[model samples]
Target chain A: MKKQLMTGVLATLLSSTTMAATDITWWHAMSGQLGETVNTIARDFNASQDEYNIKPVFKGSYVETLTAGIAAYRADQAPNILQVADVGAATIINARGVAKPVEDILVESGYGFNNQDYIAGVRNFYADSNGKMIGMPFNSSTPVLYYNKDILAKVGVDAPKTYEEMEQVASKLKEQGYATFSQSLTPWIMFENFKSRHNLPVANKNNGFDAPATKIMINTPDMAMHFNKLKDWSDKGYYKYYGSDWDANQTPFEKEQVAMWLGSSGSFGGLRNRVDFELGTTYLPYWQSMNKDAGRTFIGGAALFAIDGKPKKEQQAVAAFFSFLTSPETQMFWHKSTGYVTVTKAAYALTKKSGYYQEQPDAEVGVKQLSLPGGEWTKGYRLGFYSQIQEIMHREFDNVFANRISVEKALNNIDKESQVILSRFARTVR
Target chain B: MEQRQQYTHSALPYFLLVPQIAIIAIFFFYPAAEAVYLSFMLEDPWGQSSLFVGLENYTILFNSTEYLKSVVFTLGFALVVSFLSLSIALLLAVKANNILHGKGAYKITLTWVYAVAPAVAGIMGGFMFNPHIGVFTEIFASLGWDFSLYTDPFDATFVLVLVSVWKQVSVNFIYFLAGLQSISYAVNEAAMLDCESDRRRFWTITFPLLAPTGFFLLVINLTYAFFETFGVIDTLTSGGPGGGTTSLVYKIYRDGFIGTDLGGSAAQSVVLLVLVLALTWVQFKFVEKRVHY
Candidate 1:
């Protein structure tokens, strides 16, 4: 019995010395080249730290990974960190004990993280109702106008700025026998980015940032004009609606069949490589002719959250890893690797000093589009049941674009349908 | 019956039954019980927390237009997939059986399609039918027919149905070939000597004899269409062009897993369970009398 006790103690000591670094699993959804970049980030962070080891597991797509993390948490095997899409921020936060607030992590650790260093639009998205950070903004992207220079030159326009001007330009280009624009019919550009660009409230109560929004504000007159404009222009062959998302939308632009393509900044690297045509990217068109209070767009990618119920040591290790990711140097590598927007002001400044933007001007467009001074509605919208809401939005858009209903009726119907989801979600959360 | 032997050791029987019972209990009963329990409760996606809300989830599902539409959609999809796959496979098996030369080669070629994954088959269909890049779409365009699967609901559903039928044809084909081959050549020669036409012999003599196999395949194919067509639908259309192809199973996955409406999704599953149970029961009760066996 004495020998057995001594052997157990010796084994414990051996493990303590050999396995000094605490293991913290990180579940993420990045795939392909972006997946490689995620691994590189973890490897760099692991090399930087002697205390914590982060193991990044690729868990399918965004929805799949988020579901896996949640399923893990339910099974009492959740990882230390989970990378979930920005849409899931509210869902994760609202879930009573699913995630540990990043701000709380920093406060407890007393780590010197300058919150002000984060870009305002990106930072505001992951903040809670009290303006406290809940998730780390990682690989954030926003839509930009990708135009063919040759087509714009033939049409005698530099770059269209407002909705009305774009309409005129599209007409001119079509008259010259070129289809003016082709966009992915996904809700990211049509719903979220459009709302942000026009400073319109997509939902009530400060776009659901201040509190759980009680109503959807997508039926406002400003929203109608944009849809109406798309309707009229689409009737005149000014636009082509591709399949539901970015990869599908890039096909026409890659084929040089369309002049204008509005898509995510994350596709910048691929867009540059695929197109032989002289490509020029500009800001997503605003409705300056309608709403003068329009503001800059917000981020569209996923963020990292420190999951709850982890050991204290594992939590600190996750916090340390997050700090390393948020550093300017690591952020630079991440931005260039994925063509996602730079998350930190210091990172942007350092990239500027490095003359990366001057070397590749296409990378500068998304930053310029999103880094504008804030307006009343500049902060992004978050609500529960957004996945359901997104599907409804797609269906309602088809109603208008497919000639089943007028834009006016479609808008009203969508509002009513969205309210049903909102009310049901309100009940579920309560 | 006359040679039946009773087990002298009762414990031996229990020991022999242990693995099967344990497996069924663990794999099937436990999950079913959990789903039934969750169907009555409002829960988070992770099942981290739940509120017992009685039958509210079922009520909400009943009231939901999307759920109602998906029910009709699932019925139509299963009907189309089952009928098309069975009929097409029957026709192919008949043709292959009629051919005397290279019969093995013909059967082998047809059966090889089963090796392809449903998603991979859907993707192959995409390569053929995609409007922008498809060779078939290009042909249709030249013939003055516009084809855009992504933009048209019927086209989207057609693509899903086509891919699903393509994947399932092999299983149906194997069953059908066995059934067709089981019919004796002596019967066919006798029917011909009796002066019956080829088509008439197939319809009047051979088809009735094959009804048992047909009845068995009908049940299997319906189940396959109802439960196993998710990969095809997801790959080709993602149940879109506005939920045109969203079956009951796909909707459950989207809501429960992707949309994170656990209670609602569970409620959907319970409703689906009752539906399938009723369907299968009716098929077995009434349809079995038509079988020759």
Candidate 2:
């Protein structure tokens, strides 16, 4: 018995010495080149630390990854960290005990963390009702206007700043036999960006930040007018409708068939390489009469969240890894790699000093637009099932452009349909 | 009187059936039974909490215009895809059987598409029907047809049906070819002697002989349309332009997985299960009896 006991003790010591670092699994949805960058970041973090090791797993698309993380949590096989989309923030936050607040994690781990270090729009997005940080902002993107400068110069007009100016430019381009604009028929651009920038509430309860939003306010006159304008533009052949395919507009934009393309900020790095001509980016157009000063647009990418129920040591490891990620050097590397916004001010400053924005001026447009002062309505949506609601918005709004439904009718349908989802989500929350 | 052979050792027979029964129970019965149970309750996204809503999910689904519309679209989509694929496959098989030269080449060329996965097929179809760069779009445009699959529901549905039928035709072709070859040469000669027209002989004699294969393929195609074409619809249209092409299964996935409305999605599954069960039963009961061996 004494011999066996001695052997066991020696084996424990040997194992402890060899397996010193705590293992942390991070499930993310990034794919392709972006996925490779994620691995590099994790590898660098692992190399820098001796106490904690982060293993990043590519878990399909954003929705699939979120589902896998939730299902894992239920099965008690949850990862230490999960990367969830910006829209999924509300759902994850509202799901009690599913996540440990990142702010708390950092403070408890004794990191000199400041919430103000993150960009305002991004910081507001991943924060709770009481303004506590819920998730560490990672890959954030916003909508921006990309215009073919050659085509615009041929039309003899700069990129539009207001809705009326956009119409005039569209007409001007139409006369030149070029389609004026094209965009993804997504609520991220059409609804969320438009409403938030105009300081209009997409839902009651300050776009669901103050409380659980029960009513959808998408049918406001400002929104209806915008849809009406899009329909008119579509009818006049000023705007090209590329159906529901996300990458359909890229061909037209690259071929100079369309003068302007409203695309995600993250697409800048790729668009720069794909196009041979000079590309210019500007802030998303707003209605001048509605708002003299436009509010900020919401972020559209994913953030890293520390999962609950992990041990304190694991949580500390997650915090330390997050700090490393937020550092200016790592953020700059990630930004240059994936074209995602540098989440921290220090990172943005470093990127600027490195002459990235000077070489690619369009990359700064997203950061500048996102750093604009945000109002209560512009602090991103906190409604549950927002991803599905965004789908509904896209579907309904696409019908208007298709001439199958009127703009008013589409808005009415969106309001009614999204209400059911909101109510169901509210009920499901404990 | 004829004596029927029976298993003398009942335990051995039962043991022999255990693997199949166990697989069916674990894979199909368990999940299906769980779906039925969950359909009657409202569950949260994380499944941390659930409420016994007692048929509220069903009521909500039945009352919702969107859900009902999805059901109708699913039925219509299945019928259209199955009918189109089977007819096209049968026509190709008959033409190939009649051709003496390059029969093997034709058979091999036509049956190879069965190797492509549904998702890959969807992606290929997506590129081919892309509004701007797609060859089909350019062709249709030159022909003065506005074939924008992204904006127009009709255009999207057309592309979806076209892709689905194209992907599904290979399996149906192989089955039909096998069925055609299995027909006795004597029977074909007899039909040729009796019939004056080739088309009439094909319709009257050859079609009846191929009825068993047709019936089996009908069930298979319907099941494929109902469940397997999800990747196609998702990749092609994503059930958009006013939910014009959302199949029941697609809607279930969107609701259950993306939307995270578990109870509602479960209810949709139950409805789909009932629908498929009813369809298969009716086919077996009413249609199979007329099919000759």
Candidate 3:
């Protein structure tokens, strides 16, 4: 009886310790301040729950992290959670059997999952047609206008509310020898913003999310007008065409060389830290003459994905942590820290009640823009083979910027390349 | 009995070489063979599965206009960079040979720059050429010229070739210096007795003697231009301004990694391998034959 009691006591100790904690590895690409925020959330979650411990690892940049995850998945050594950029959404969705749906995991774990709680646009991109959420929307943000208030005041121009006013301001700034009025030539900024604001279809079949095999719809007259205006500005020395993307332009703007910069709302935090001069934020300027009813800009930041290859118990752990991530407290913290829009309506309300926005007014811009009533364009484009399409778009835009091809020819080439990619994607999806 | 012993000793060297041969076959030959095999297959991006497509990938690569343009551009770039690097290296080697003071310091400093990572150098070069804030750009602007190297194809090529030559000059200079040092002082005395001009003496004696080193450098510089410059190209232009700055290897990276057309990229790789092999063989047969060594 004594020997049996001793054995039972040892077994009880082992069981208690085993039940005390389960470790889950989350690989993410957030660095610096953002990495600290992720760590804080993980620590809080670990402390709140005695059952599971979430370990967050800082992988490199977004592209590097995604590539590493893909390679690791192929090798059957993938992490439980991965942070993929917005462009990677379609790629992750198409990677069937490689990822677990958050909805299914939640339901299996007996945690009540609701799709309606999330912003429809943000939630739908990560969901299947039957409304299964594939990933949790984390670190989401939309583009906004950032202007140097000092430069604007010096040029005697208010922050431009309309595209025409922006043009006038740009001309005045150039005339006043500001060197550069604005410094980005990214298509997502120049083209996607225009399309979203005017409610123009960027692609057929609700920007190719409803149907994966949709052709490019960006060769319209309005797009031509946008390109022509940019070209005119380039010729007139009113605008300085930086390279193709944000990084190339942000350097000059950070140095206070450029007068205005159109960038993601998440950039508010970065500008607040980096810029010595006073900075002002505004909604992206729209073409007033084209349509009176222009909407918010498309979202640009990334979300979190739950990869496959874990057991049912581990999946439950992931679901729990994901729930904790999307919880009102975590979302509010993320928004207040990073200037990303709160993914959940409750988090937004919580932030408002806490008067976080009152302390930092620029934090409210992302929410205001996303909350606008403009239909599908506001939802942002989702398409299969999106990575390939984005590459083609960047390349053809490079061609235009290089003056190797006309805007019409470049768009036409993009249309052809996109169709080819779309057709291949169609074959697979079908 | 002596002849049999000599044959056994000669055969023992072959036996000794077996391990090295096996290692080469396992590591290098196996992967090269697999790459060749992969050239005939189509890879699905999402599925990451490859299917046999025979010559279809090669056909696509051949028909690609961008690939054709890249081929021409890469060849021209390689030639220009190789010649420029060789010339500068030879000049520096001669100057170092004549220098009486701080010769070791100069050599060490140049060699140290070569040891620095190409990616770091490329980044520094990018900053130095940045149109808005770069010191070089400001100076060029003051001279009344637009110095946007990132946007201009000619300027991009110039920067690429300049960086490539700059990075390589130290290596080639070391090789040439060693070759120059190896030559006997008797040759110079003989030329002096013949009363030849310095230029003529160099052309007739020093140049001919240094042919072996020059030939070696030519091959080394060409290969460097082909493979080693990818980091510089990626960091500097990212094959940008309408793919004007893309070299052959850069195109291979784009096609395989970014384009997700692994088979097509593999086919292009095979073509590149064949071209390099053929060129090397030609250089050995024709150019190396002229070397005095």
Top DockQ hit: 2
Q: After aligning candidate 2 to the native by TM-score, how far in Å is the CA of A135 from where it should be?
A: 0.9
Q: Which residue segments of model 3 deviate by more than 4 Å?
A: A1-20, A178-180, A183-185, A255-257, A428-430, B1-19, B46-49
Question: Taking the tens digit of each residue's C-alpha lDDT, what string does model 3 give over B95-145?
Answer: 788789999987887666678566676787888887666788888898997
Best by lDDT: 2
Winner of 1 and 2 under lDDT: 2
> lDDT tens digits, residues A53-169, model 3?
889999887767777787788778888998987776766776567778888888889988888888645666577655678878888887778888888898898988888888888
Error of 2 at A22 (Å): 0.7
Q: Write the per-residue lDDT of candidate 2 for residues A248-267, one digit (tens) a residue.
A: 86678888888889989889
| Runs off by more than 4 Å, candidate 2 | A1-18, B1-9
- What's candidate 1's DockQ score? 0.51
The predicted structure with the larger TM-score, 1 or 3, is 1
Q: Clash number for model 2?
A: 2
Predicted candidate 2 versus true structure: per-residue lDDT over B24-79, tens digit per residue: 99999999999999998888888878989998999999898888888888888899
Clashing pairs in 3: none
Candidate DockQ values, in order, are 0.51, 0.69, 0.36
